[model samples]
Target chain A: MQLPFSLQPLFDFLGQFTDGPANALIIVIALIKIALIVGGLLQIIPFIILFERKIISWVQDRPGPNRAGPWGLLHGILDGVKLFFKEEITPKGVDKPLYLLAPGLTVAPAFLALCLVPVGPIIQGAHLDALVSFLRLDPSIIGPGGIISEIPLAITNPNIGILYVLAVTSIGVYGITLAGWSSNNKWSLLGGIRASAQMVSYEITLSLSIIGVVLLAGSLNLYNIIDSQAGGFWHWNVMAQPVAFLLFIIAMFAETNRLPFDLAEAEPELTGGFHTEYSSMRFALFFLGEYINMVIVSAMCVTLFLGGYHGLFPLPWEAIATWITNISPSFAGFYPWVIMASYLIGPMVIVPAKVGFFIFLFIFARATLPRLRYDQLMDLGWKRLLPIGLINLVITSGIIAIDLMVTGNGQVELATKWIIGAITLGLFLAWDLLYYSPRRKAQLEKDYRLYPKSAKKGEKPALAS
Target chain B: MLVDFLKGSALALKHMGNFIIGKGNVTLEYPEVKREQPAFFRGRHRLQRYRDGLERCVGCSLCAAVCPSEAIYLEAAENTDENQVSAGERYAEIYQIHLLRCIFCGFCEEACPENAIVMGASYELAMNKRTDFIAEKDDMLDPAEKGFGDYHEYDPYISHVTPESDKSAKGDPWAVKAEH
Candidate 1:
């Protein structure tokens, strides 16, 4: 039976866009989505500042900057103004050039990481056909591939999309390292060293935990992963990969340098850390840069594992999308709806929901959790999350093997997601029940020191001969 | 074993009182319930205006000169016979106290020969702007009549509280304004 022209037009347009009303609308929505997500981030960063102040104050049981704007928002702005005019103190014996360059280095990566984050529902709207006839191009000379595919709003949507996130985020450490080194102070050196060590140790676990998500998704392209989970509810990674989710969220807090992890400028004691010697606006840059890093991590967490901007859950996407197309012209014309729901709904609804959730989670954690002693932080990274990553992978591989053995294929295996979740919950309880006890932690440290080196237990401790 | 557990329970209850009922040192709900401030309390400072609306400060550089912490910085312009603003020969055209540097010693108050400047009780001096702390005479002055009675209106300068109530009942005459 010949499928009629109206249906044919919709599918044909979608399969290969002719820069029609639909395609143009999709492009415009993508650009608007980009602007909205980025703009929301710029506006949200200040409130995160307020959120941080309020939460910290509450934790300490004191009022924070309450005088500025309603809740000290004006104070944050006032602080910025003060920074601009206040003496830009340059420390003695500091490297004048790199000292200046370092703060921006930490900040720029934050915006870059936000670029791929999906934040709004993809509303079908006016999109310009970016493809155009160029005066210089001879169609004959221009190879088929030489012509650009319609340039998507994303800088690039490569198969290795999230690999870019991992690579770029690690680059943020350089800024802190340089700031610490360039300042030429002992405290800065100590701070830079700790930041480097913490970030480097955790990056491995952070990247590894997300691999569990990547494994579950079975692809690296962020848009494709998001696209695969379009419509109603349950298909998002949170339920499926609970352990990986926990690991990722924890590592994210550490990565962003939110409190407990905010030892970088653990003031009064740190006396401003690496920027202690910094005066005026030069120091203010470092301060804003820290907040920017927090924004980047918060945004990434929203996009990754949380379905970017998917609604609470997606129903069996293929079934729903297929049924709608069959049932009504309601779904007939809008190919972009599937993409737009994620683009529009996820970001407008889900991303903000997730970002708010995580920021609160961050505040709650700071209020509840005392900082890990420096060594303990390093241990959690190298000894704990790293091993857990390997164990998770082994179990995942074993599940894949079982699914292959039982079904004779590795595709779409139903592994024991419940068991994995239980195990993850058990480990978290163990961490809280065991490692979370400060008295126990202190005792353990004392005992650890008391126990002599195993290799040299029998020998007298060797003097520095 | 029962006794040990009971002892632990007793200890826990004691701690529970401390944790739940309150910390032993409960902070007062401030503003509504302020503690009686210390004997030598410094809450807010006011610059005095005379009965004829003249200032008492003579533009003698002594306050700035004598300030050991260099917290006080002053500049003077002579008040000639044609335009006399102060009872003294001079009035301070520019007087600044760098509170950031101030040790809060009453040295500048003591250095005034005319018994002009006195540190008052304004601890509400938090500043988001450094320029705010520069505090021109207008920001600092008492704006009160020279008569003994004007001292304690909620503010002699800008009293939301009656300046009379605002005044400490008694202290050094220079520091405290007396009601006529």
Candidate 2:
């Protein structure tokens, strides 16, 4: 189980200083990976905030925070500093314990869930065995029985990756609920209730939506899911599971408390929502939690649907590498490291780019759509998305089951899946354009006609007299 | 529904595209760049003077009488041969306009028989104290050495429209006056 592009060389290098077992070295490497991912994510979160502001402003035809730094890059940092120094107000009669615990609770699950996301591919065939030998390191010191094997790019890859993500993210609503309840404010309570109800309602559809991808991939492990879609862009679950993709994205918005479904934090209705009584660093934590949640969901979407860490077009890397080596024989010695670097760096870039696009979509939706009414939010989650998700799941499983029974291959052909996906999307579009929209408009008009018309133009309706 | 959603998104994307290309942005970057007010825009009031430094007001009190807000105050004094302040028999001895109370309707300018008061283009009338809002006689007086000190001199467009030749051109309906 030799992991392609393993950090074993670095592990071996560090092993020189320690007389500990290989297991200890593995723990140290895992800790380093965790620090790098978490620290990198924390550092990037501020910029994501700035990016959101700038993008929202751009959509509205305004220059957002250009004064903070060049293109307002430092604005998020300035905001963080401001929030840090602000006075933390604990409202009188508030439940102190839950109030103190809520923000951390909201943020912790998001970070924990992030551990399961594979931001890069575990490319095979990039053995650093040559490098290990070149460094004069004995094989016995590096691993059990000196077998150099697979290492995951993710901090941790649990077998139940998607399930773990769902379970952990579900816990986030508790923090919101606790925050709302402990505040002793009606607004916060209303926001918290809304958040809980909304999360619970959408979580059903959110989970249901991903089952199509899970069924197709035949694995819940996020890394395995990504591996299933490793061929190219067309092979991505988004292409095969278009209906599920739509449902998942919509449910994702509701689950994350973002606009169009952000009834929990609907400013007009609930003021600041569950965090209304919160101020200073406590409030900042909630804010941080929301943005982190956004990042996590975006990454999750990429992992599940958008071909995690895979580029749109498949390039002939082996051919390119050979061409480079053939040009100069001296480059042959460093060929393995070059291959490892490509494998390591390629997904590192691609994953963020994909995740960034989804994040941008989040901002784009926020800028474009108005917040859904509370009833409408519930209606969408239950009546619309849930039903659609169920139908999609039924149809998806039906196809797979039929394919397995007929072909005995236990897999639906890509062409058949692609055609079905296209047809499903096309049919939905047609139905929406030809049937649903006009009928909805007519119904709205009929509802409008139920009211009495003004006697004359610009005049009040005549009284019953 | 999807079409409508896409339309709305396209509209926003279009605006974003325009923003990126530096189009359709109405923001003035306010403190750095001020907007140009219209020609007939009523703003701060200024008292005028004649070419020989004689006061334009004849102390007729028409401005005070016509002021809807009663923001103006004045005291008339007889002008003798030794102390000839105006081209008329009397001069405004004491004059003040309480800006805080002023509606800035340019009625005083219209009512002034001697063209003594005209609306200046200085709209930034913020003051630290309530009393500081009151424009004294000297404060409202044009700080000019000679000539009919028209407040429009500061605005090139207004100055260009109402040239030096049109100093006393009154009630000429066909004349090219500052349009709103």
Candidate 3:
């Protein structure tokens, strides 16, 4: 089923002026998609900031920004305008070139990585042909008279999608490091150095955690990974590789420089961190980069573990279409359009909803947890998450290898995957409940007994422990 | 560790849920709505007067002497038959209180022998300039029509404690009003 209105007709219309491989038409469509996506992302950043404020405020039992526009909807835009009008201060004896370049470096890579993310399912082949027939146009007019193949929802679907995302996102730290060094301020330099170190340390575990998902999916292309997780929620990599999901999420927090891993920008210790010397719109750019990076990370998490755009229970589009057609023959034309609309719009909606959940989790964690001490942040990343990720990767590969040897196929059966997940989860729970909890309680009791009692009603206790 | 994390998060979620249901919000929406201060609340001071439009203060300087911050200053002048100011022999000729030094300790009110000075329920004492903080005699004095401006007039316990015998004493300024 295909929607009656699609870019196919527009592509065909534009194909008339283009010759030689229809590259011009493809470029035109790609440009339009890019414009829409980038524009949408820019527009969404302010609201995401607003959402963070609102959620944090809510967790603190206060009404958040409710005065700007009904429920403070315009608060984010107003903040942007305020930041735009503020004076940009260039401190003395700073590296002006790197200082100026830092904000751009920070923002550009996140947007670049967004290019490879598959926001919606590909619209192609039969759908495009159906669209052509609906428009009563000759198919040969576009792309050598054949259907224009696939119209991917992504801006650009690179074969090395995950690698590109990892590589591009890692460069965001350079912007922070340069911003810090260029500021010629102690706090900024400290923040920048911390960001670089923290990101570098976590990047290892971050990439390692994803290897489990990559192994399970047997593809590094994000779209293929999503495809492998299709059918149901259980098939999602999160269910198959829970340990990886946990490690990935922890590493992701560090990579994003968010709390409890946000030692880079720890306000009490590092002041404003890497952007301490930044002011006005330059500061806003760093903020924009941070939030957009958050969105990108959330999107990647959704694409990898949360089944991308796949809904938990597949919608009965075909059944609904058939039922509608059965109810009235006159509404027969509405059948395919309904299915096609679902096909086009379903993933677009589902993916954001999943991403929004992750974003909310990010905000929730910030509200619930205190910023980790710098050493603790590094310790968690290097000692805890790194080891867990490596172990998870090895165990996953060993299972896959054994499956290959026994069944002549590398794919672990769904039952085997469930059994592994259950065992991992069970072991974690048992350790926490039976061992860790009792030991912690006994330690607390012993500490309480060791605590000195007050000497008397009016006398002071000794200061010595 | 994970369980503890989950528990902490669950507690936050509980608070958030309560906030959404309008249960846990402690914000007072200040400025638009002012809180009602208790009658005993120590605020800015007010000089009292008698029913016949006579000043309650006899220029004894008890409040000035009792002020821990030395915020109060006053001078006394003898009252004559033609120019009677206070019901007593001496009247306060010049009275002032430096609000900037005042700690709102209610000590001055407690030490007033004539029951002439009392703290009023006006805590909005913010002023723009240093000179503006030096409250003049007229500024602290009650209007002539509203006799005996002791804030204890609103306190049921203190109002009931004024001796009934004092009501019959001639020229006694400590006499409680009949309305009370």
Candidate 4:
């Protein structure tokens, strides 16, 4: 086994201090990486909350939060301060330890799951080129350079990245369950039970949906998955496995307890559900956890389906680097930053922008769709999405098998993708139409009856208020 | 059925897209942009004056008689040589409208024989004290001079509705003749 790429430099620097093992240096580097990722996430969550509000308001045609500061950007900050100072209240009878532990449990998994998701590309080769060409640093001074080549804008890359995310997210249910159960309130208990059941049911569909992507990428590591989709928009999993994309999006919404599938915290029914007994910072943690989870899920969707860090157009990095170098003698040193930015920071911006679109969709869907009844939610997860997901997995695996057996050429693979994508789209459209036909007809007739234009003179329309 | 669902979603998407692109917002920023009140809007009452600066009220007590809320109070006095207040023999020595009891029904405006008590557009009648609700003669009376600092821009919609009314109120005989 080799030392991870990011820890090699640390080990090299610490080598002179003592003739000691590199394990301590590696651990420190790991700790620092973890701190950076967590700090960035904590800073980002409030803005995401603010963005959700702003998008929701814009969709509904109102200027939202422009009063707090420029475009109401500081409203979230003000809100966080307000939540912090609010009186912390624990109701008459509650299980003390579990109630306290629940919010932390909910928050921890979300933060941990973000570790494996790469936000930017590894820029080792280019950085090496830049170092050799621009900086004129001694090659030997940057020790073990070839060994520590992978430079990713993420905390760490585990071999089982996808599995880790699924496993960690599953554990998040316990937090909700404990929060509801420990509250000693019937509503909270009901919310907990609903959340646990819903999450469990959706987890199957969620895992099964990703089976298609995994099969296509042939890797569980998120960085590898994104690397596999680096060519163009067409190479994204969304095109290759359209069925899986649809299933993942639906299941992701259910997993996160977003609206339409948000049975657990259905404000009308559960009165804030599991977190009803929480107050101040505890309540704030749960809220923060929810938004961070949203960011993580959005990032995952971008990584999996939209081709994470892949530019929409093929990036001409060498040209951009040359342009920067020609700008002036002073900018020669900055060419490396420019080159790294084109490949690394460019995607850093693109990935977030794509994730933001999904976030907007989440908010838009909340505004557009009504909540599903409890039975409908269960039936959709168990009966509809599960079967559909299983069928999609089988189809995807079948395609992969065929590709391996027949002419294993790139052209054949492209043709296969197009064929499978078309078939899946047709099937989905047919299923959706058949499922919603009766309701559509009923809705139309209901509308006609309510506002009948052919009402006789002196006769009133139904017009029930 | 699938087509229907798609259609519904498309319609919603179109509406939202229009709004995002800066369309369909009819919301007025209330504090900044006030709405144009209608000509018939009976807000706080005001006593009118001729352009030549003569009070229109004859102190006939018609508005006091017709006020359903009993919000009006007046005291009649003989017009003196040095302080001739009205265009008639008698003038209101003390006229007050207790806005607290006033129903804003415009009956008082309709009952004024001299067309003196017309409701102006100043609807911000809030007061810190109970006594402040009572508008004395000074508060109700129109400005003595035209283009007074206290005057507001009149609504074009109201002016369009009653073009002759403004001219006659301003004592513009030429405009009244042109209208006739």
Candidate 5:
């Protein structure tokens, strides 16, 4: 298979080691990488859940779940343990196999999609060569014979990365639908149907919204996408396609079935939704799947719109890496690794910071917004976001076309100014349409004044007028 | 339409921001930080002692009779030369306050003829066993170091006790207030 332009060097470096019996070592490393990603995600979801509760409580001006551990850090962990010990109850006349398969189906794709999420720098073939030469490790051992663990930050960097994410996440719907249908309970069926319908409706907008960034990045590979956003903040897709960023975030909430978009598991209407009949570890799996999905979506958002790992200023990693190399001849083998670490630390920190910002947004939205009625959810997804996504795509493409035309004549300076002007204009127009308008202020005041009795509770009737 | 949505979002953002940046959290981590109880707050009842290390209860059973919840129980016994538990002619041989039934209304304290019992500031009355809720006379009695003067420093009924009978009772602040 053909590798992406950026990854060709790494492939060539690894190619020398992929001889006969040595190939099995690659498999070992691959398995380890997958394990690390899955294990890290499993450990992280509990904390994310805890943070969600803590953030929501803070927003509501309350201290949430402080008793379980220091600042309630162990609350989610204890809840998971409690869920594990709970009796596994399968109600009468359930499709047992499908019911069992539902949770695995839901959770598998959440982890699968994360393989494409780049958390740090991809170590190139040059770095691999440097490490191999300095360490003076056996060529047979280094190649693919013994310890060939030059692991990239991500598990895999498939060419169809974004498409892979889109496909896996959409498949997650089947799990919910199956769980709901097999439960044979009316509420579970309702929740399942609502979930599938909501996911299906929003998936279109979700994918289409992402297309705006895909066009701007000019690539499907997640690494390439982040690479294009390098240099500075303005170069980021968020600054380029701010409309699409907003659209994608809204659609992401629906896709994840988070609050305000969580019509499927609406506790008041459906006791526990699709997992109503599920108990013990089976029920816990669904919870884990939901939180992991949140992490994936937040990571995706960081990669696509927020410049993944790119900090505000240009990081002097190369100079620092060289300085480390010069200082230690004895540790020359480790210098490349040190360089890789220094280079990766920016992205490793910044990307999580970006993901954390979105996660906070998710929790904040949950704390603030009421769940949209099912019909309202559908209307917003189909009638509102779908059209907005298409429009954003067109706008992004038009800007890209103008950019291509202007840059072809070697007048780069003028083209940049034009793009900046256009972005600012678009942002201003969006701000006006969405937030600040005299018409909206007048309407708000009119609504307030219309409710004279309520208004008079805090003010005189004469003053209310 | 979008403007209204954004306006609502702004309101939510403002609320969240104010909560994060402003000191709006009213949550008190209980068991860590306790709230100050008011002066008239009725809580666990304690038996008082006079300055001479004598029990104040005369075994009149008025507190037990007045207890709306019937939480108090006592047995009267003669105070002799060999053993005198109180300044009065009789003493309570067995005094018990059942905390489970105690209403914490201070009525027992109000009905005490000798001002033997007064509601204390200790409100943590949690007990694991049903039997633990029954506080005995010894558990409820104030130690000898705490005298009737310390207990009735502000007692309203202390003035009613004759000055010739109990010296500490006449110097009550409420007694001065009652005269005014």
Candidate 6:
């Protein structure tokens, strides 16, 4: 009763009147779940677009889009609608067939990657006392002998989920590749080449960076990995393997081709990169794909480092599980429809809302940072992140070994070592912050002093006040 | 080396809380928190005048010509004996700096023949539309007597040694002027 119900009353009314409790619950859950994702995306996509504009403007010391909807969040909406209505102009000389197909290529793989994401607790696993069971088994993930018998909210609990993610991510390159190559434009070709090289280059490091996670989790399935973090913040990968988190975040940025890493379509040179010739819905799809990929990468980051769908505070997830299990007998007496409705909506609505917060973080980041150049991107992957990732892997292995030797348990439990982990993470972040601050200041000073007057050859001189 | 590295890292960790979340950011929010702009910071363009009340700009389109972004516009008019604004034969009548297009490169300041235009620290030029940004001569003209001149009231010749330099140079009777 203290649920402070938003959608609860509506489900209750539906159960009492037309449908049975069981069926009505399932229907309500299913409908709400779909609404949550679509609604969140519509809002998240637009605001992120506006936020990016605002951030970029401040970086270059200019005012960005702020005239559309409240604080110009509707600018992306305006863009989307305009792109949809505007002419889907297919240039005459281009390969019309592939050009049409290219945008979809960008979008589909992101959705595929999202399919494996565990947004919330699969209730069966959380509450072991279960009358109702929802267990999905894929041999590819859990292995041949291993069988996880549980009830969950995920669409499909694939065993080999991590591998599936890596494979699907690699597939996203095809969309950009097709868009660039099929366009028959020179800029498009250049964009495709750059994207292929960058995406391919980063994919190697990205996969390698997450190897530490796989080693630690000992399972590819995201559910098991999430469950491992059930112990709390200290158990979170962010603390234990900070270097891996760093590499993973950077790689994901490159993988998604966002700012600083977005040389593929830096606008002035590439003129919108691979999808330059695209127009109308096709163009919109590519745009949507970019944002979706951004969300997916952020989601993946949360999945690996932040506890995926697990709340920071412990009050609610346990309470919800108790409430769900108690209502089971009442569902049995009621009609099928009521019980079914509850089954679907409970997870669907709850899941997306949780996922939306991480998505917001991604948008926040895009709003705040600048894009990197191609060479700098290479240097980071090869020199910095890769080496650090390796060093971290070695150090973590040593820690795990020492823990096993002392306690006779291979597991490095956070309850005992959280302070140490926190200190280690705190120290590293501080050093980086202090070390980079001076260098960054000096480099920026050099750039400013040597720009415009002394070196106006390649640089677009800053316009006079 | 290992122990030293650990110690250095631990020191960083100890003070980390004071940095990212606390107030250790090097970046000053411009026009809001207001960074201390350099004295020669070339920002918004403003018109100039000589000490003797004659306009410093000699109807020269050098700023407009040398502008990389082509941001400045100047229309020179001849200074007649009756209606002379400047010491030179000609004076700028319709001078405009399109703030929207201005790149802040200081080229307009650099290319000035008479040193009539110099980059100032007036960085607060944010506007809503393109039209609002087109700063006219009236906005840029130095308010000499109203005490808003480029090197206003204060004696320019005085270094840090002269504590009383903030006072007006009214003793030099030629420096007296009306507001622009």
Candidate 5 docking quality: incorrect, acceptable, medium or high: acceptable
Q: What C-alpha lDDT values do all the predictions have? A: 0.63, 0.80, 0.80, 0.76, 0.76, 0.65
DockQ of each: 0.06, 0.61, 0.56, 0.31, 0.32, 0.03
i-RMSD of all predictions: 10.0, 1.0, 1.4, 2.4, 3.6, 11.5
TM-score of 3: 0.81
In the predicted model 4, the residue pairs found to clash are A433-B2
Off by over 4 Å in 6: A1-43, A54-73, A125-151, A316-370, A405-410, A415-465, B1-180
User: The CA-based lDDT of model 6 is what?
Assistant: 0.65
Winner on DockQ (1 vs 2): 2
- Per-residue alpha-carbon lDDT of candidate 1 for residues A1-465, written as tens digits (9 for 90 to 100): 122322323433553654443454345445665676667666666677677776655545455567667757777667677888997777789898888888888877766776766454332122211112211222222223333333333534567878887888888878888888998988887888878888888788788777766665668877766654454335555655666777788788888776677666666557777677777777777766676666567666655666666677454544555666878876675543543443345445666777787777777666655566677787778887788777766676566556556787444333344455556656656655665476875666556564444436567764331
TM-score: which candidate is best? 2
Arrange candidates by DockQ, highest first: which order?
A: 2, 3, 5, 4, 1, 6
Q: Please give the distance, in angstroms, between residue A464's alpha carbon in candidate 3 and its true position after superposition.
A: 9.2
The residue pairs that clash in candidate 3, if any, are A140-A145
lDDT of 3 at A88: 97
Over A40-112, each residue of candidate 6 has an lDDT whose tens digit, in order, gives: 5656676677766654454334455666776677798898788878988888787777777778878888877
Q: Indicate the worst ten consecutive residues by lDDT in candidate 4 chain B.
A: B147-156
How close to the true structure is residue A422 of candidate 3, measured as C-alpha lDDT?
69
Model 5 Cα lDDT, one tens digit per residue, A1-465: 111333234544665677533354456557877786678678877898988887777777777788987878899899988988899998898988999899999999988897888887765455655555554434444533335535467888888899999999998889999999999899999999999999988888888878877776678999888887887786777776666777789989999999999988999989979988998999998888888888899999999988887887766776766776778796555555667676567546777788888888898889878888787788788877787677767666776677768677422233353364377447546755765468777776675564444544556555445
Residue-level lDDT tens digits of model 2 in B1-180: 887789899999999999999997868776678766544667788776766778777899999999999999999999999999877899999999999999999888877766778786677898999899989998888655634544323322233133543522443434433321
Query: What TM value does the first chain of each candidate achieve?
Result: 0.73, 0.90, 0.90, 0.85, 0.83, 0.72
List the candidates ranked by TM-score, beginning with the highest: 2, 3, 5, 4, 1, 6
Show the lowest summed lDDT stretch of 10 residues, model 2 chain B: B151-160
Cα-based lDDT at residue B137, candidate 6: 82
TM-score of chain B of each: 0.64, 0.78, 0.72, 0.75, 0.73, 0.65
The superposed Cα distance between candidate 1 and the true structure at residue A8, in angstroms, equals 24
